[model samples]
Target chain A: MAGLEDLYREIILDHYRSPRNRGELPTPPAQRVEGFNPLCGDEVVLFVDLHDGTVADIKVSGQGCSISQSSGSMMTAAVKGKSVAEARALIRRFKGLMSIHEQALGGEADQLDEDGADGAGADDPDVKLGDLEALQGVVKFPVRIKCATLSWNTLTQALDEAPA
Target chain B: MTAVEAGRKAATPLDVARVQADFPILARRVHGQRLVYLDSAASSQKPRAVLDAMARFYETSNANIHRGTYQLAVESTEAYEAARRAVARFVGAPDPRGLVFTKNVTEAINLVAASWGGANLKAGDAVVLTEVEHHANLVPWLMLKDKLGIELRFVPMGEDYTLDLTHLDRLLDGAKLMAFTAMSNVLGTLTPIRRITDAAHAAGALVLVDGAQLVPHVPTDIAALDVDFFGFTGHKMCGPTGIGAMWARPELLEAMPPFLGGGEMIRDVRLDGFTTAEVPTKFEAGTMPFAEAVGLHAAVEYLGALGMDAVREHEVSLTAYALRALKERHGDDITIYGPSEPAMRGGALSFTYKGIHPHDVSQVLDQKGICVRAGHHCAKPLLRRLGVGATTRASFYVYNDESDVDALVEGLSDADDLFSL
Candidate 1:
């Protein structure tokens, strides 16, 4: 249970039980992207409303374990009403948090490899994670790292699809 | 002896403590706790005997089977063939010559679909399957459907998680083949194979039984069941990986084309074209799984000594205990998805605990050293039908005992406590 405590922090479970910005947005007004952890069937559907270089509204709707769903909820809370550039920076920083320990262990985090070396910036002082920092515990359990990052990756894809 | 007599002979209960000692892995500690492995439906842990047999094969008779005339090669070939005979006998196949060694059950099913189905089936021909089938049983037929335009029909699962055969004849109508599982990997539903085979035969259809989950758990007599083809894997039967088998009828094996084209399967290789080898060799194209066959032979011998009936009896009792314990402890909080009758199902108990996601439940359980499988269990369509994205499955085998089930019940409480809203 000592290891379990690190993986499921109190803040993380709160987000899972009561996910923030949870629902679907109409596709025409919002760009949607879905990320799947095929190993566990954990899915994350992101709907981002990017207007005038700002994420005017964002919602996450999917089903997954506490780590994935809570990470998604915390992500929506952090990125909503933020600039597109700010959101992308948060995504990189969050992924950095998830992949830092994985890189140290020399684990095969193929998903993290495509981010172009942003994983080393986990401790970047410029980026403040706020509630999103709760998910930093997920790196301890390597398999759940993908669950923690599923929403961030989907958010990245959603932002790419949205009008800049 | 008859199947019923075999069942009577299995009245001698197995010594579970002695059985656990045979598998070395069960003794190891995980997270400072004893390992309570309940995922045998996914893949079983091998015993010391199986391991020793494989090592012995490599040490003594490590050579290319059926290729060299050297002493080692001759011994290797004999050992491999003997393994095939033992595995075939375990399933009650009349002739060992009909058994073809495959990589795993997936490859075995694929071999049948590509070889037998390819040679016989045409566009619009229906291949009836069941809703409870694993992806191994489903994907191959789906691939054939995509390639040859063959129609696929499914026998629906009843509310009790058993196969609904109310319209079996209707689904098997005009069907060229009937493929289904003997026991579901996820639900542990023991299908009425003889009934299904009879219906399929009456409707002039050949039957293929996916025994990946069944052959390892119960008394399986392919001759008694009278199915055209049977596919199973070695890993699920306390044997090593990289080895499985497909047992087909002699006429069907003789008629079907070779699955993989390479050395060891040709009768005569000419400048222009080549003639195929005989029945079993015709399908076994490349190098045989020599060491794995030896391992499988030892595995079957081990299981034979334990007696499959005793194995089934142990599982049924353990499953009954688990079912009662899980429900009694958790009540409405735990929803186990399978047949309530232990006699009706295998040891796989797929469940959703306290509305918590299966991955979370499994993660919490893993900390307690309980190895349970979470997620779709490779039966996505079946999970969709059950209206759940995933489930935490705790399957029992000969190595598992009442204490393992108790650990699982206690671990679920721990998960419930951690996720209590």
Candidate 2:
């Protein structure tokens, strides 16, 4: 049986307990979107502030299970202050990490290893997933995948509808 | 004893052991312990009779009805129509033609909302529903309101969880339809259906009763209650899943348009237009669940043999015993919802332990080989009204005995210890 340690990773729990940038952003230059998982009553509201074609700020407020809340917390922290292009790239990378295809990246594993402990090497040939790689464990539990991706999906929607 | 003497004698109580024998699944073990099922309100355990009926249908008489032209077709048609008669008789409908088979009660309610509600309700037309309605009953009407620009109203429940008729009267004005549950699945409050229906009819509004919880536990005669429409499911009444019935007045069904259009529901097809079939068949589109209908028919026979009055009595006794036992054992440690009078409720109890979440209680019960349901139970609005996020519900059926109730109380006590504040 997979223990709570795998599910409630210390970093995830820390983020859930004290989520970063948790609030609403003003609507003038920011776009807001809501996401809901009907199965377990998890809901998330994502607000994005765009400044000069970059994500100046990202904030989230919601009530949900620990996995969803922590995932939202991690998402906001990962994309904050990044350019629109960078944020979109991070989303794609996060999707790749959560996808079942990650196991096929074996040949590129050594290149990823040289990216340093933070997993932030842009020069590495391998996919450097950064902090979002921690969510790979969620795929084992099929039901929790929705919880982990709900906020990211909401953020995608918010960014899509955001004024250019 | 003479036959008259035997007939006059008081009926024997429901034999839990004998009843348990009819259910094949009950003989098995779950989690290395004997299964103690206490979640019948969620969905009932199917019996051998229902299973065999379904299997027999598939084995012998497997053909499309109302569209085929062979010996197997005739037999299949007979069996399917017989099941419709069985359901109609079981619910005391005046005619079998009034019963429309759907996937389940949820779909039945949706059919009425889409068909009858769409044709009748207009902009500013009001719909009065109770706070205790299942999402099946609530959402369809809300969808109708959103589509038609109608106003929706709610009848509030008292602190005891019973519908307040005084408030209902006030909300009835300008209401074109009143939809409610005969018995709440979560709270187990048996709303006074006859009174509410009569009042709605007097106000010139039609009433739809969601009988998913009530039909399994008690005998329902649509003629006696004079309800405009009643919805019930098969799986909740010891039948196979994927089949249910909606009983509406013949005229009401005749007046409503077909919900889903397809082969069975059409009289003739043309490139230009097609005429619809009669009531019942008009609503049942596509290839029907013939085997499931047979299973539901057998379930009706099983309940009839047991006698609904006896079943209701047994539930009353069990619920009363449970209420007293839980109250005596826990007192301030628990908060029981719904009517305190057992006779006023159905075969379930919804309660909250003072300091434990329902999920925690369910886990403790699961350890003891007892299965109960925890969560909002698909009635989020009612749960919100009760001022709780969720509840621990233990529902009873014919197979349940006092021992099951004792086990539940013991499990809760254990949960209290394990999850102390």
Q: Identify the leading candidate in terms of lDDT.
A: 1
lDDT of 1 at B313: 88
lDDT string, candidate 2, B1-421, tens digits? 9884465245666787899999999888765667889999999998899998888888999898887889999999899999999999999988899999999999999999999988988999999998888899999988987899999999988876788777677799868999999999988899889999988988889999999999999878889999989999999999989999999998999999999998899998999999989988988999998889989999999998887877888999999999999999999889988888988999778888964657557766876788998777888898778877668899999989899899899889887765453
TM-score of 1: 0.97
Native-referenced Cα lDDT, model 1: 0.90
Off by over 4 Å in 1: A100-113, A117-123, B1-3, B6-10
CAPRI category for model 2: incorrect
Supply the TM-score for candidate 2. 0.80
- Can you tell me which runs of candidate 2 are displaced by over 4 Å? A1-35, A42-164, B1-9, B328-330, B354-357, B360-364, B413-421
The residue pairs that clash in candidate 2, if any, are none
Tens-digit per-residue lDDT, B272-310, candidate 1: 998999989998888878899999999999999998889
TM-scores of the candidates, chain A only: 0.89, 0.80
Please state every model's RMSD to the true fold in angstroms: 1.9, 6.3
Worst 10 contiguous positions by lDDT, candidate 1 chain B: B4-13
